[model samples]
Target: MIIPDWLSDLHFAFSHRGDGQMSFKHADKDVVLESRNRFFHDKGLNLDSVVTGELAHGAEVALVTEADAGRGARDRNWIEGIDGLVTDKPGILLMTTHADCAPLVIYDKAHKILGQAHAGWRGLASGLIESLVGRLKSLNGTGPSELHAWIGPTIRACCYEVDRDVADRFPDHCRFLAGESIRLDLTMFVHRELWRLGLNPDYVTDSNVCTSCNPEFSSYRRDGLNTQAMACITGIPE
Candidate 1:
């Protein structure tokens, strides 16, 4: 698995090799599909299970249990409207897709509970991060201090401009770019949310890669409607 330089020592894993590449694996496939196939083909995963949602930018979190195993690379009968997924089952990869939205991954090492959340501005404002953490705690008795978090690549403050209406939705503590056009720092907002949830700042790692600034990444802000998203996935090795 390719680990980006900004997220060193987090122990949580994700792929970064597709950077600057325009192959079918990165361009055409959803992040979950690409990650599942890579893990399977590389002989790193024993279970082929993957779960995601319709991602309506809400705070809903779906639980992936043993019954949901081996569902990866298969079409579902109905899409669940959720922004986060959590599981303790080994080989059951929990994934969330993002183009410019920050992909948040959390792992509770003691309990082996892993979680992935999609945090766009709307999701962030809706308290998705807190919802995921609360669910993890309830399901696995995992506390904020015991969990490790990784914030993935997304639209950075340099390119994520927001109007007053959107900016007002966030807490006053969030950082913002100055000027007539107000750009917000989403990664910082996520970091603040982590802190608010009682997770130590030291336990959180930020990718710091701006999708809008880097041509290697897919960016809705840059490509408009044509942006292809990347996936951030996590699970216990079976």
Candidate 2:
């Protein structure tokens, strides 16, 4: 597992290739559960206390509470239509699965609020980050400047070629042409978006670990539909 140093003092983690397949979508239920159990246990977290999003690649951000714990730990009944989750409730982990999509971790230290998001190309275009920040503000008035964020491993521009349709969704500055290939820099897009949202650039960190380039991560672009996935998990410890 890759624990971000920027948020190393907190209970936050990004699963790695050797952490086993964290997603249940393409794996056996019991096997996936076992993997998750072991992973969470190793991190001093309880799998039964975790809440995950359905990850529809939409803009929906759900405000989670203690009652929502373990909703997706053993089954697929996660918060529906949610690509992002925000909560101030301690001990209930917010997690989202990813193959190559970017995993976002947001924390409001003053209010003790947490936000977790899965930002694929579609999710970013859908304004998922905006919705998540808005939810954080509503929860306890945590504004963009007060939020600290981390963008985890994903398919970086070096490997993320896109068609015109996908390229048009973001600003040209975040996309560039490598010869004839139009590649999009997801990290750059996310960073610029956060800056536009009024978040302090110093408080935001990007892992810069490209999933497609790094063998330690699972990449859909590299492994296709049969690829196993990693997961991003974070929470406030009691």
Candidate 3:
């Protein structure tokens, strides 16, 4: 588990190797998840408390509750078409799957509200960050200043070559010409969005790990169909 240092108030982790394939969607056929079960069991986190969505790669942010816990644990209890989740429930672990896509970990310590989002280029274009912020705002009015977002490791512009069609969706500043090919800086783009929405620029941290270049992390764009996903999760209680 790769833990971010700044998020001191919450129990959060962006899992890499040794954590296993968290999702059954891309689990290995021959390999069982008993070790994976033991992993969470050691942390005293019930897999049943983990909440996930169907993940449509869009901007649908869902409000999770204590009742919504375990919806997507070991079964197909995910909310449909949602790419973001915000919860005020303490024990409920909010999670999102990623393989080169940005795994956004959000926490408003003052209000004790936590959120997780899966933002790829499509999700960014659809304004998933803004939607997540908006949802948290409505959740007892926790504003941007109180929220601290950590943009977890993913493919960066150095290896994320894109075409014009994909590049056009982003701001001109977020795109750069790379010898006839365009590269999109997702971390920069995400920072711009969060800052634009009034989040303190200092609080928005990005882990500049490029999944495409780094062998330690998984990248679907680089590893193709056989790749596994990384899970980023955060909760209020210990």
Best by lDDT: 2
**What is the per-residue lDDT of model 1 for residues 1-238, given as tens digits with 9 covering 90 to 100?**
2343333422234444253211222343454445446654553444246566667788998888867664434444213678888887776766556678888888787787878888899988888999999889987765699888888888888888888999899777665657778878878888888888889897787777888888777787897655555655567766
- What local lDDT score does residue 124 receive in model 2, on the 0 to 100 scale? 96
TM for candidate 2 is 0.95
Candidate 3 C-alpha lDDT tens digits along 58-98 = 99999999898887766666898999999988889887777
Q: Residue 182: error of model 1 in Å?
A: 0.9
Candidate 2 segments exceeding 4 Å error: 1-6
Model 1: residues >4 Å from true position, as ranges? 1-47, 70-72, 76-79, 175-177
Cα lDDT tens digits, model 2, 159-207, are 9999989999899898899999899998898998899998999888878
TM-score of each: 0.82, 0.95, 0.92
RMSD of each: 4.2, 1.6, 2.1
Q: Which candidate number maximizes TM-score?
A: 2
Give the higher-lDDT candidate: 1 or 2.
2
Error of 3 at 146 (Å): 2.1
Write out the backbone clash pairs for model 1. none
Ten residues in sequence with the least summed lDDT for candidate 1 = 17-26
